[model samples]
Target chain A: MTEEGKQAVAKARAILENYKGKKLRIMEVCGTHTHAIFKAGLRQLMPENVELISGPGCPVCVTPADFIDEAVWLATEKNAVITTFGDLVRVPGSEMSLAGARSEGADIVPVYTPIDAVEYAKTHPDREVVFLSVGFETTTPSACLAVQRAEKAGLKNFSILTANKTMDEAYRALKDSVDAYIYPGHVCAIVGTRLTEELTGEGISGVVAGFTPSELVTAAATLVELCSKSDEPFFRNCYPRVVTRDGSTAAKKLVEKYMEPADAVWRGLGIIPKSGMVLRDEYAAFDARKKFSVPSFKAKNPPGCRCGEILQGKCKPTDCPLFGKTCTPEHPVGACMVSQEGTCAAYYQYGGVV
Target chain B: MCVGLPAKVVSIKDGMALVDASGAKREVSAELLDELDPGDYVMVHAGIAIAKITDDDASEAASVMGEL
Candidate 1:
């Protein structure tokens, strides 16, 4: 094993050995950690007393299907070019995905950064370029910057279909709902430890952890220990090198400058008030809602898809009847099985089964 | 969703810094900090350097961690 892996394993073993035979339930909020746990075989090594669960950390999983349909609709427009992160293209919509639409003569392009979307519009000034902006705090600043750049360049053809949400709201929504939270290291790096203070006040214990087998085990063990001690919410940094008391101020500034808090709809969680960010009026020229006149479409969850329950921390991937049988990664019925950082995809990729 | 990390500023040019994180290198904005430079660890989120991390504090915490 690598040195980091060995250290993580040692720490995890120490945590497990110390908490063996104790009753505890811990939930890791990051889908990446969920994948790491199974990938490292930590679940097999963990004591029976400690139960680890998955939370709503996957951005693609939480995105409602209506948003996917809207993107697909935009892709089908005569002169409209749809660009998005690779993960969104294959996520199954109620009727079809963008990939499926592309097969039927829709113009769809996958780009890594949001800036690439702006560049596409700049290159093809006559074409309507829509950047499908989706992510949490980590990617929000970039999407905001893209909007600013579009406005600066006077690229009226450049706009974004934003589905950006903040991490604190999701954490707060899950506080009373879960036993303990294994907070996402990446998300925490943006929001920082201050958000944990509020989570603790609501009686949730949180530990920001990295996405490695050993790091996941350490987080699980810390959670068990914290749960064994008190009902008060605790904020412990297992990923202290990456996360701090205060998060990224510059990213926060960019986000604040270009976007404002707005209500967003999650596939399972319904409409969360002030959980999403929309482009400010100053950058309204880059807003997709204004650029395209998309008709309102009803959001629909796939039949027999328990992604909603899985997202709410009420059920595991195995609890879903279609987990491995009908809803494998190859033929996913929901977004959870589509994205790499999604809970279902994590479970399917690793050795998790229903 | 958001995937941010901590990086150290290695050099600064035109309101941007050549930042390194555990062997990963990328250009980041140095507009937020007052006097950041080489060997300084700063919290990096979404490709931007947000704050200066004190070496003393990090070392003290690392030492405590090593003891653990």
Candidate 2:
């Protein structure tokens, strides 16, 4: 927390006290908020009328099965090198995981950045390197820069499989699920405050939040203020330090130059329109999908996973029968158990749920 | 949420900064930010120095937070 004090807590207590009989169904649509809320025990602190639900914010959790299957296919069938974030490597598809494929001699490397993949491609000229780019607006700029770097270096073997998503579409689809929203702060830092402003302007109570525990508490108190005081939806910024109304112009321009918005398939939410980024035709040679067609196969989630319901804010992780018992983090049965940012994994690790 | 860490800038070369993130040094792009120095603290995310955090900025934000 940036500053530790008793005033914010007292103010939040006052707000919750005022809303004793009224219910505020607020959904936190950011993975960090989910973790922070649980870590701070804010759910336990809030009154019962203050219902805080987790949304489909974790990119690792909401990555559709087919995307993983395609990454696995590229490695197993085409013998191409796979590069991705650590969390994605363990996510289970319908058939196999990238780790499973790696155990079978597939070269899938976990990297801290997309630049590492570019470096790998530069060194291994003979091998086809496909960077599995999975993230939101905050990471999409780096992915674009990597593609630009690879092109500048004249790396013919490098391509990217992008699964980047935008948060606006999800908010649009989930408007009715909650009375207000605690938006993702880091995400808003990149895409700008316009996202939350847009949603709020449309009659959805919302606030952008920072990752700190005290910030979450303060944001909850602010949300109660906005919802109870105004019939009209309003926007509040709890993370004024990092996020601005316009966001990073340079990053946004690069994204516009390299990628275009397309429909994306979220794990629980299914296909949401214009929520994903795809490589532009100008960057056609750097697109792994255009270069090598992944073998098409029917995708399915694990039986009794209930990850879909969890992603949609319809149910909690404990609501699922396999949450802690059959789907522990060590051996995850669903995508939620595979990542620390995931709702189920966070609840299990924190040893409590809302 | 995006994974980020505050790192100290080591050196600049070709519009990239070699930064030390908790003892482990890694090269990240400095294209997204404005000014930088060898010892300045930067918020790095996905191999890019996204923001430069200063004492005034921190305290200003903290004061606002305390007000909440």
Question: Can you write out model 1's per-residue Cα lDDT over A1-354, one digit (the tens) per residue?
Answer: 545555555665776776654566677777667766677777776677767777777778888888888888888763579988887888878788999999998889998667678889999988899998888876777787777778879788989988888777877787665677888777776667887866777677777776545555666666666666776667788766566777777667878898899999987778888999888877777778766777777867778888877887788778899888999888988767878778888877775332
Error of 1 at A311 (Å): 1.0
Q: List the residue pairs that clash in candidate 2.
A: none
* A1-354: candidate 2 lDDT, tens digit per residue: 223345555566577666754677889887877887887778777877778888888888888888889999999889999989888988888787899999999999998899889999999999999999988888888899899899999999999998999888889899888888888877877778876787766777788877666666677777887677768888887777677787777888889999999998888678999999999998889999888966665687778889888877788888999999999887888877777888889888987444
> Which candidate leads in TM-score?
2
Kindly report which residue stretches of model 2 are placed more than 4 angstroms away from their true locations once superposed.
Answer: A1-21, B21-24, B36-40, B54-68
Candidate 1, B-chain TM: 0.71
- Once model 1 is optimally superposed onto the true structure by TM-score, how far is the C-alpha of residue A92 displaced, in angstroms? 1.5
Q: Give candidate 1's TM-score.
A: 0.87
Model 1, residue pairs in steric clash: A138-B2
Q: Tens digits of per-residue lDDT for model 1 on B1-68?
A: 44445677888997678888888898876654567778888766545565565533233233323534
List fnat, each candidate: 0.17, 0.35
Q: Candidate 2 DockQ score?
A: 0.43
The numbered model that scores best in lDDT is: 2
